[model samples]
Target: MNWKKAMTATVAISTCALLMSSTIWAHGYIEQPASRAYKGSNALGLNTNVGSAQYEPQSIEALKGYPSAGPTDGHIASGGVAGFGPLDDQTSTRWHKTDIKTGALKVQWKLTAQHATASWKYYITKQGWNPNEPLKRSTLQEIAVINDKGAKPAANVSHTINIPSDRSGYHVILGVWDISDTANAFYQVIDVNITGQGTGGTTPTTPTDPGQPSANAWSPSMIYVGGDTVSYDGKTYRAKWWTSGEMPGHSDVWELLAGLQ
Candidate 1:
C-alpha cells in the first residue's frame, strides 16, 4: 500500500483502541446504594476487612426491612434523629466488600437529615474498650465521612475511604452525632454495593449462588424488603449476615444469602 494509505489506516486503528480503553476504564467502578434492599428473613449479610491484608467472613442477622421513619423516601420509609447517640460508646455494624481491581471505593447508607453529623470510621479494633476500665470503648480507624442533616427516609450519601496497603479487612461504621440540642439522631443501614475494584491484572472467578440462577445480573437498582433481582456474571457467590467476631474481626458461616445476579 502507498505511504499515505498506510498512515491513514494506522491512525484509525489507534483512535479506536483509545476509545475502547477509555470506555472500559469508565465502566468499572463500585457503586453504593445496592440494588434493592435485602429480602428473605432478616438473617442475611456479609463482612469485609480494609487495608493490605483485608479478608471477609460470612454470617447471619435478622434484618428487618431497611429502617424507615414517619414518611418515606423513594420506596423506603423515612425518619429523623434529634439528640440520640449509642448507649454504649463502643458499637458494631455489618460489613460490605469491594474489589480493588475495579477502582471501586464508594460506601453509602440510609439516614435522616435531622442528624447533624454523619461519619464513617474504620478500625482493626474496637474503640474505648479496655480490660481494666469497665467503660473502655472500642477504637476504629477513621477513613471516610458522610453528611445527613435531615430525616429523609432512605436519605443516601457516600464517601471515599483510605485503605492502607498494610491494613487488611475493613468495615464501615455508620454513626450519627447529635442534631440540634435533642442529640437524638437516627440512621439506617442497608444494601451497600462494592463494584469495579477487581484486580484488572488477573482472571477473576465469577461469583456463584446455588439456590438462585447462575446467570444473574445487577444494575443501579436497589431492593428494600423484597430483594431486587439481577444476574450474576462472576464466580464464587456466597451470602450471609456478618457480625462481630469471636476474635476481633473474624467469623464463620456463609448463610447462603442469594446468588449473584
Candidate 2:
C-alpha cells in the first residue's frame, strides 16, 4: 500500500483499539444517595472533593470474595483497592452524608458499562457501631440481597430495601455488585442519616449557621472543637475535644448535654 494509505489504515486501527479498551473497562457504581464515588447533589457544599478518580477509577478491576472474603478490615470502604484508602480514613472524618428518614429506601446504581450481574448485596453499619474507626465486615449487618444471576442490569439499576425503623443517626451502607462472569465485584459505600420516620417522613431540617447549633442533623465532615455543639436525631451534643468523622450520637468525642429537651 502507498505511504499515505498505510498511515490512514494505522490511524483507523488505533481508534478501534481505543474504543475496544474503553468498552472492556466499563463498570458499575452506586449513584443515588451518592456513593462515595458518585458526583451530584449529595456532594454539594462539601469542603473536600469526594469525586476522586483514585477511589474507583475506570479500568480498575473489582475486588473478589466480598463481605466474608475480600477487602480486609482497613480497606472495606474502598473495596480493598489501593489509592482508595482515603475513603476509609478515620482521621479525615468528614464524608458527605445523605439524610434519610427510616423506612423503605430506594437505592440506585449507574453502570457506565453493564455486565451480567450475579447479585447486589447491601449492608449497613449496625446500630451503635463506631463511625470513628475504619469500616469492617463486623461493623456492618447485611440488610438486603438481590440475586440477579447473570441478568443484564439496566444503565440505572434500582433496588428498594427496608431500613430498620428503630435505628436513628449517622450510618454507612455498603453495596456490593457481584459480576456473574468475572471474579470481581464492585463496592460502594454511602453515608446516610436515618431519622425515625416512615414513608413520606419529615424532610431533614436545613443546617443553621456554623456558630449556632440548630436542630439540623450532624455531618461527619463538619469540624468540631471543644464546646462546639450540634443537634442530631433530635438530641443536642457538646464537643469535649477536637474531632471529626465521629457521629454525634455514636462517638465519645462529643458529650450529650442534658436539659436540652
Candidate 3:
C-alpha cells in the first residue's frame, strides 16, 4: 500500500479500537439520591451543560481502591477529581439534597458503561458529621453491601437498603461500584437530609416476660456467629458470618430477616 493509504488505514483501525474500548468499559455513577455530579449537571435539573462530560469527568482512577484513609476527602463527591471541585464544597448552594427518612431507602445508578461487578457497597456519614469539611473514611459508616459476583448490571441497577434509624439531618451517602475484571471502580456521593424520628420508634416493645426469645437488640461490641439472631432499629437480622464490631444495618455480616415475628 502507498504511504497515504497505509496511514489512513492505521488511523481508521485506531479509531475503531478506541470506540470499542469505550463501549465495553463504560462505568457508572449514582443516579438516584442525585450524586454531586449528576446534581450539578442537567441530568438532575441543574442548568450546567455537563452533557457527555457528565459520566466522563466524574469518574476516578479506581486503582486507589475504595474506603481509602488518605486525602481523598476533597474528591469525595467527584470521585477524586479536582475539576469537579465544586462538588467537594459542601457549602455550595447549587448542591441539592434528597429528603429521606431513616428506614428502607432505594438507591439507583445509571451506567454510562457497564462492567462485570464485584460488589456494590454503600456508606453514610455519621450523625453530627462535619458537612463543611471534606469527607473522610473515618467519618462514614458502611450501611449496605450487595455482591454481584461479577455479573453485569443493566443500564440501571437499583438497590434497597434499610437505613440506620439513628441517623438524622444532612448526611452524605457514598456508593462504590467495584469492577470484577478491571482495576477501576466508580464512586458516587449523594447528599441527603434524614427527617422524621431518629432511632426512637424503630424497635417495637416486647412482652414483659423475659423468657421468650424476643428480638435481640444488636450491639457493635457483640460477636455474632451464623444463625445467631438480633434486632436493631425494629428489624431482625441473622448473622451471615462470624463477625464482631460490624453494625447490624450496615454490614454484610448480618442479613436482615424480613418476616420472622
State which candidate has the highest lDDT.
2
Candidate 3 lDDT by residue in tens digits, 32-60: 77776677665555525433435453354
For 1-261, candidate 1 gives per-residue lDDT tens digits of: 699999999999999999766333221011243311111113223322211101100011111222222212221111211111111121223333333322224444433222233222222223232312211113333333322223222334344333333333332232222232242333322222223244222111222335653324332342211111233344322322111111111222122244332
Model 3 / residue 36 / CA error / Å = 1.6
Q: What is the per-residue lDDT of model 2 for residues 146-196, given as tens digits with 9 covering 90 to 100?
A: 665476665767666777776788888888888889888888878887767
Q: Rank all candidate structures by their lDDT, best first, as comma-separated numbers.
A: 2, 3, 1
The clash count of every prediction, one per candidate, is 86, 2, 2
Quote each prediction's TM-score.
Answer: 0.27, 0.63, 0.64
Model 2 ranges with Cα > 4 A deviation: 1-24, 39-51, 54-61, 91-93, 200-261
Backbone clash pairs for candidate 2 read 65-70, 94-221
Runs in model 3 lying further than 4 Å from the true structure: 1-24, 47-61, 69-71, 92-94, 198-261
Worst 10 residues of 1 by lDDT: 52-61
Clashes of 3: 2
